[model samples]
Target: MTVRPITITGEPVLHRPTRPVTSFDEELRQLVADMFETMDLANGVGLAATQVGVDLRLFTYAFANDDDAPDRGVVINPRLVLGKISEEDPDRDEEAEGCLSVPGLSFPLKRAEQATVSYQDEDGVQRRFEAHGWFARVMQHETDHLDGKLYVDRLNKRWSAKARKAIKREGWGVPGNTWLPGRDEDPFGH
Candidate 1:
């Protein structure tokens, strides 16, 4: 397994939808392993294929639920069915979300309180499960990446402005920008 460099926002691969995983071969398995290695090193709960410059629709996640139980695995070609988005404003303190691709900043964004995801596993076996709370949030966040949407893109006007400023200040939003875990400093402060 290798820790690949994570792409920043505005990179073409991260901004466009990825192709589905059709071959469940050893190469795909190796990519999944590399993604997990990269995600763990960067201290991210989820890392999508596009984040690492791979245009395949898959993501690796390792997050603990509200009960503190570990929920860790990979999802390929996911079809996420989200519950109604909460009308209540996102509690900034509780709902702030950050991206490994956009590191170091987290912005508040309201999201569905529950979600159900159907996807294939490493062996091309189909699976489905429901989630809630932070786990649900992770599912939604990662699935959005598959559709070429970042969490910042869904921010409201106020938060969007803030995110935009930060992106500019950091000199991001361009192609060929990446941060390698275990080599570069973790802007996410992991």
Candidate 2:
């Protein structure tokens, strides 16, 4: 598997909705493998198809759950169901989120504390999984990608303005802006 360059936020592919995964074949398997590799190399919890310039409704995640248990898998053609969000989070600072597409910058955003995702695996087997706390955020974030929304898009005014400045400073948000995980300098500074 090869590590693909993750597209920056302004790319058209990331702005539009992704197509659903239909054939669970060898090609799909290869793509998932490559995405996992890319996500790991970039030290990301989750990576979506649009981030890698693929317009499919699939994402690979490899991160410990909210309970510190190892949770890793690919979600294909997912439908995410979210629980109520607590607006007044005492640990609100912990909710700051970043994206591979946006590279280094992070901004605090509200997200559901619980989520249930119904999806298919790489083999096309249907499955449903529930997540709580930060894992729920991961699921929600990745699901947003499939619908052409980025974490930055959901940021509140204060953070959104700051995020916009950062994007402009980095010369990102343009088509064809990408960085290879290992080869290129990490904009987020690892």
Among the numbered candidates, top TM-score falls to 1
Each candidate structure's TM-score, on Cα atoms with residue i matched to residue i, is 0.96, 0.94
Q: What are the runs in model 1 whose C-alpha is more than 4 Å off?
A: 66-70
Where is the poorest 10-residue window by lDDT in model 2? 85-94
Q: Which candidate wins on lDDT? A: 1
lDDT of 2 at 178: 88
Question: In order, how many clashes per candidate?
Answer: 0, 0
- Residue pairs clashing in model 1 are none
What are the lDDT scores of the predictions, listed in order? Answer: 0.91, 0.89
Candidate 2 local lDDT, 3-104, one digit each (tens): 999999889999999999999999999999999999999999999999999999999998777553248899999998899986663244688998989887
- Give the TM-score comparing model 1 with the true structure, all chains together: 0.96
Model 1 over residues 24-89: C-alpha lDDT tens digits?
999999999999999999999999999999999999999877643248999999998889997777
